[model samples]
Target: MQLSEQCVLITGGARGLGHHLSLAFAREGAQVIINYHRSAQAAQALAAQLGPRQAIALQADVTDPAQVQAMLATAAGHFGRPLTTVVNNALAAFSFNGDARPKADAIGWDAFQSQFEGSVRGALNTVQAALPAMRAQRFGRVINIGTNLFQNPVVPYHDYTAAKAALLSLTRTLAGDLGPDGITVNMLSGGLLRSTDASAATPEAVFDYIAANTPLRSVTTPAEFADAALFFASPWARAVTGQNLVVDGGLVRD
Candidate 1:
């Protein structure tokens, strides 16, 4: 679907990477549904910036199915149309501080479970809630945010990385199953971003290291990665699905 015809719901669209994604989609003429878990002020401000016609901020904890369902219904009501795109970008509370991360031996299943709930279960809730509308229209786009750690594992963020890996699997399987319904599912994975709430705890030296090692000689910005998400929701990617496009400036050349 063309961006102008799409209504997109971006979970956790108030801050960090989701903030940029919200802006990108709005700029492309899509009606944006900025779903925030706690950043209500930020979400509302962003919606105002995008204008009432182009965007609206809604509160929902993506991990909760009832909230997500209600949020989707409200989004459709506001736009007078069902959401044609869904971006699963809500992340659990996490800080990408390698030094502070719990070691694999010390980490409990709870850590993994939390990330799973955020990354996998959250996507599950939104996709399931939005499926009927998409199927009815015979068109949909599902974009799952992922990480490059699966291939490089540079920092070995066991809990976070493991959960994203499972999400990747879901992305591919969904692509296969949903393609027949005119829906496309894909993943956009990035390495340690230059700056985000989650990446703020990362050491400057580490950022420098990543930048120097990347083929682009720079750390990827949230805006850069967010722009790529537009492709998965656009007509250019109509025939593309079950794919993982790494947006870390060629850091992991798989």
Candidate 2:
């Protein structure tokens, strides 16, 4: 019950990692606001299951500043409390098939820009939109979902990895700026989550390689990563900010 009476907003909360995080937050007694771009049915279904008093869903494309603002307004109106935590977990619908991988020389500006728009710009929009309320309440936790691939780079997800790295940079800078307002900003990076839709196309060999190489000799699950997120939002981490926690079974020790 570390998050009791807290309000949290999670982008892309309809499915996959986001979906699990939303449910985890609700179980901790948080009033959860889940944001979905295209998974309207999934969002509604999740909200219903979590119970109306603890969970609500909003539709917004995080890449658009206007949409983000509207979504925040809607959440505030419905919950009667400004968001205490914001999770920037949305990503563009890009397949990461091996053959589809773009080499540095082959990647066009559009390809790189699209990833940045969804990951970096989306985080910025959420941070900016929630700052006023956070400052007023003197408490905030901004957790950006990152990727351990940015550190190891064993597999070159050029555009996606770069975008996540940019988000990490933003998280640190925001932590410095918002520290005085009692806000903590942190990033949680995980390596090759076991059961997320994002990893559906990842080869079995790749999974086996990670499992064998990681310190724990296994892959991390979405629930485990979500628990790390919850810790950042908890009072235990009040003094912990501008940091990145790698929940990758100690695979890439940075």
Candidate 3:
């Protein structure tokens, strides 16, 4: 399906990478539902910028199935169409400062669980809630945001990397089960992004180091990574599912 024909829901669409995802999808003529747990101000401002007809902001904690279901219902009602595409981009509270992060020996299970709740459970809630509509229409797109750390582990962000790895596994399995239903699931992973709220704490030297290592000789921006997400939602990627397309400028080849 063309992106313009899809009613897209982007979780955590208010700030950071999600902000760019919302803009990119709207720019492609997709009806965007901006989901946010907190960032209400940013979310509302962004929806206003995108315009009410093209986009709307809804609040939901993606790990909670009830909230997710309600948000989806409201979105469907407001847009007069069920969501045809979902971008799982919400992240748990996290900072990208390697020095500040707990080492393997010092980190606790709570950290891993928090990330898991945000990454895995959150995706599960959204996908499960939207399944009926997706199945009914015989067309759906699940584009999960991932990280290249599973392959490169540059800073060894144990909790975050492990959670994203689980999310990737879920993406592939969902693709296999939903492919016959005309639903496609794929993951788009990127390395340390140039700058995002979560990555703002990253040391400048780390960004320079990544840029110097990548073949593109530049750190990927949220906008650049978000643009790749459109391919999965578009007809161009109908036959491509259960794949992890790394967007880290050749930093890691899988």
Q: Model 3: per-residue lDDT, tens digit, 89-187?
A: 999999999999999889999999999999999999999998999999999999999999988987858999999999999999999999999999999
Instruction: Tell me the spans in candidate 3 whose CA falls farther than 4 Å from its real position.
Output: none
Computed on alpha carbons, the lDDT of every model, listed in order, comes to 0.94, 0.90, 0.95
- Give the worst 10-residue stretch by lDDT in candidate 2: 93-102
Q: How close is every model to the real structure, measured as TM-score?
A: 0.99, 0.97, 0.99
For model 2 the local lDDT of residue 228 reads 84
lDDT of 2 by residue, 20-70 (tens): 899889988999999999999999999999987888989999999999999
Model 1 lDDT, full chain set: 0.94
lDDT of 1 by residue, 45-150 (tens): 9999999999999999999999999999888888999889999999999999999988878999999999999999999999999999999999999999999999
How does model 3 score by TM-score? Answer: 0.99
Best-first order by TM-score: 3, 1, 2
Candidate 3: clashing residue pairs, number:
0
Q: Kindly report which residue stretches of model 1 are placed more than 4 angstroms away from their true locations once superposed.
A: none
Evaluated at residue 206, the lDDT of candidate 1 is: 98
